[model samples]
Target: MPQIQSELSFNGLSVLYQIAHLLASGKDLELIMSNILEILETSAGMKRGMITILSPNNEELAVDVARGISETDKRKGKYRPGEGITGKVVATGRPVAIPILDAEPTFLDRTGARKGLKHSDLAFLCVPIKSGNVVIGALSTDRVAVQDAVTLEGELRFLEAVSDLIAQVVQTRRRDYDRIHALEKENLELRRSLENKGKPDLMIGNSSSMREVYRQIGQVAPSITTVTIRGETGTGKELVARAIHQKSPCASGPFIAVNCAALPESLLESELFGHEKGSFTGATAKRIGRFEAADNGTLFLDEIGEMSLSAQSRLLRAIQEKEFQRVGGSDSIHVNVRLICATNRDLETDVREGRFREDLYYRINVFTIALPPLRERGADVMLLADYFVKKYSRLHDKNIERISTPAIDMLSAYHWPGNVRELENVIERAVIVSTGNVIEGHDLPPTLQMKDASEQGERNDSFENLVAAYERELIVDALKDTQGNQTEAAKILGTTKRIIQYKITKYNIDFLRFRRGDSTGDDE
Candidate 1:
């Protein structure tokens, strides 16, 4: 029988302490679970940590949170009672430890984490997580195999203690989980309803973040409350405002838009509220402002953060009183207009800095809808890109079919600093410049071609090396497209055949694999 190491016992205490702190932190459940797994790995010498929760029907255990596992594998990591090590532990409400995973016939590696590993050196431990004797889940982990059964037993005990802490957290937060599940179901229903009824144009994503945004929009659209749409520039704040307006009761009336930053301070006031014929030198005639023009409808004030302090004061008055006096006019003109404001600027920061009027900030910020940036929208990029491609194809009268795989990769890898609007522009440009039916990698902007060195794990690489890497990629893509035909690839690249041959040799690209119909360029 082997003994538990003194150092491990000390570390185990620290691990338990940290896990308790994390569980009590009241942070997001997924985040807390991830942090706990990270702590176990770094402190307890555990690897491939996973937390599996019982299904609502108690029919199976599903991987709820995991570390050191692929998302695909995590999805595959499911087990029924008496199925595997994890399953047996949860089924019997007992702890299990296999000193050598390879020796256990019941060690089913559902996650595939141990598929090709030398399992002789691996040990598996699983403990049932219970809420007052009723098993709710299982906490499982892998560590280096120990020679002593007693050491494994000690480790199992330690894991059981950890599982106990986890159970407490699960039991306490059951209400939170239930509430989150309810909200998720509600959001799904709302999304389906929108899909059936036709979603608003420019609101293109179905990501969880975007679903929350849609839910908020739906919650506020029926009312005439002031809405402040906050997001980075090019994130389609105006589109959200329009969606709100279209869904509002005042949909039939005029929907007027104004860019507060586009107009000068001298003209901005006159722009929002009408001016008399002799109001100023530039006021040649009595022109109605956006507020009056948008009467009984929605008025979208874009870049509201850029409005001057004077304009904000007048804006606040109009919002509060539902009336305002135009420039050089004393009569109080009232109109039933619903106001929607959008801004990329940090209004809170501006308020603190005295750059914006605090009273106006509170007035328009009655209901705030935050738009997620394009980079955070995940696979929505592909959806948007496809939409833009078809839109531009029709407008430009091009017969563009689809974007190539390499082009798609470039688009996905690039961090869209300018958000959806930038993606729209990129797709339109790609469609315009694309001569063939398919948009290829070369059709993308030069910025997308050369990736950041740090992102490619070549941070120390020189500028020339980065360019060379992009050049090699282009050459390889061209070769693959032409079926390793050097002459044809040269024609596509607008280069001589000799230069193409030289580049192929210089870059060590396997042109023959392409000829053999193997798109996987292993030689390179």
Candidate 2:
């Protein structure tokens, strides 16, 4: 008897050491738990081992991992709190040891794993897995009945230790899952907000003029009609063309863009139509052209009014005949393509001056969508500014919270001659150079401050007031950056802490508002 007891003690210790190693393996939680149960069955004489975890809502327990049970049986093994042996253990936060499974009326073999076995010859044991004072789940197993009470108690105690290890892993995994879910939710919300602000297409504006542009895009996108986008430079003419192409039936095909003004007249023809090898001095290999590349798709010709009259003749033939010969290649390489053209110059004036083909202009002018300049979109300036601020803040790794009121006035008052593209560049530069959380008026370019005489007369502010306002804005921004720490603010401003205090008093600034949580500060 002494020899047998010594072997069991040594085996129990070995089993516990293996369980500890398995818990620290950093593997998938289900796979690790399954491996742990397999070890218990083979080494510790346990059988039909299973682990059950509480659901997220904590209303029911379901089998999460099991050994010696079919997957179907494992899935069927579920219980409410206090419903069965497993449920009772988790509900009461205690261990249960049934000496004979047949004698326990509460023993419900939910999995039916022991169906063929004589119930009188089986023993069942279960222990609660707890995280702090809350029971999160239960671990259970059964074995051939043990006659000695001490041996049954020993088996139950070993299972309890294994459950404790599982509790730690479960808690850690749940925390990681929760964090990932929260991040996914936050991302979904941001995408929805962007979509709402730019409804018909992702162009970003809610003004009446932008809404009209969106309506025109929607009206003409489903058809095969040629589209001409008319707008000033930097007014998002290419963006409008793209929106039409994306909504068109040819969205799945390639979208090729070319700038007629950027290419010389000598190369413009060869660019639109493929060049045969050995056709020209530097035409080394057979090169595919933009029209062929955009087969079954959209070809965006920007600044189309700049194309030479010779190139315009070939383009008009292609539009009329739906086919054209490559430069220096007589083979009429036919292609099916949708054409979208953009131009800032008036084609009517060019036609009269013989700079543009009247026939080609009429063909591309089947559908026209005019983009609104940024200066004309009343409230859209602020919307676009905020959008650019958020975009550049993330790109440059800045924490810019908001634009200051004075900066807003400056942005609203300035005429955006360069349009939306210029505004985007301005915001990106401001984000890169800002030293605090707020974008102040001084952070903007000097051009915005240079107002015309008529504009200056309307405001009629003195130079002294302007200087004071600028100074107050700088001091407030510094305080916000330092979290109301006047010493840090003063150091950032290249002044003494006492000067910062005096300035704060002079400006009637609530420095405490910048501090998070506790609204108190001390400067050393």
Candidate 3:
């Protein structure tokens, strides 16, 4: 309610700074307007301040926020076009300045906002917040001394500058709606591509852990060093490699990707190093390898940990010397290509265990980035879940507007062993099956329902009941792992089949109960 003095408040540059500071807080728009009024009152030396927003119909204006309007009178009073001086100011689409409140014949006093204040002693200044070339809303202030109206010079000019800024805010927010809609559309197209024998390379997460990923990318992208990305399978290691390629110096060039694990040793050797005609039985013609194809660009080697030992030796030579001969030819085909390798396996551990070559590991590990599994990103799970739902809904031509809050809670609680890749698949599946505007917890995959019962926050439960529920789930899970092949299950579980059978029967271990893919286990 504190107002600023006029001479010090309504100046050029200072107002813009204040407006930016106000917007940065991200408060409610109404609260923002109230603060604006209070600042005008204190700094502009106004007795009272009010701001009216134009309704969509444009026939009436709503008193969105005010500094001087009492709660009781505010509920009883409202503003309409051509009713009072404020309305006339809006209707004329120009600022109004009444020197003497009582001398103005057209003035109508309906604001019973203040009790003891003489109506005639008040002077009014009102200007509209414009829409396009026309006025959409009005900003009006009350001054006690009529003579001070002229002294409060340049107030209208200051307000008009702010009006322009508010217009920009509205325009920018309208663009956000369009952007959000467009993002949904792109997501839909990507989902369709994914459903029809295609892959979308989804990256999901906004946690601090994910921030580390972005940071590492920024750090290494400017350099020309070989990078090795490590994480569990389905954790988006390839996506990380792609991000590195995108942010790197060779971004404009080709980004050739090769899966080291998917190809056979012979085929992989030919793939990495170009082959001549008749290099092998299938080599009917010459072929360019990934290295030559990615010349002056970047080559992304996926599942690098699975590369054959012989291929590893050849790869090390090519990486270290930047030269390699074709599979059947002796000519040294030199190419300048940045190397980026991704794998779910721990290359350091593999090297120590003698499964991976230490020299190759060191060469590729010039820079390393490790991505965390999805469950570790906290609220980022919900962020990504909503993104996917909106995306797939549009792609599949569905109408899922949102995911319910409970569904978000379920997402946060569940452990995504397959990481981001698995979470995205689950969301796509739910979007395909969901039948409402919002996705609910029941719509989620069965693995999410395997509640950590020992946690006190299973909706509600005493500590003792929580523990009991946990024990119940564990016993049921152990039986499920056996898959009703009880004798073998029992031996693997280190218990007699009879005792396992007793627990199974006690916990209702019928495979039919777990029939909807109900078994919840972590693969990573």
Best by lDDT: 1
Query: Which is better, 1 or 2, measured by lDDT?
Result: 1
lDDT of each: 0.84, 0.83, 0.72
lDDT of 3 by residue, 329-363 (tens): 98999899999999888677899898898898888
TM-score head-to-head 2 vs 3, winner: 2
lDDT tens digits by residue: candidate 1, 160-269: 88888888776555556676775675466446535543456556887655876887889999999999999999998877887898899997666678999999999999
Greater lDDT among 2 and 3 belongs to 2
* CA displacement after TM-score superposition, residue 395 of candidate 2 (Å): 0.5
Give lDDT for model 2. 0.83
Residue 187 displacement in candidate 3 (angstroms): 21
Count of clashing residue pairs in every prediction: 0, 0, 8
> How close is each model in CA RMSD to the real structure?
29.3, 26.2, 23.5
TM-score of candidate 1 against the unseen true structure: 0.50
Question: Relative to the unseen true structure, what is the C-alpha lDDT of residue 469 in candidate 3, on a scale of 0 to 100?
Answer: 46
What lDDT is reached at residue 330 by model 2? 87
Off by over 4 Å in 3: 1-204, 452-524
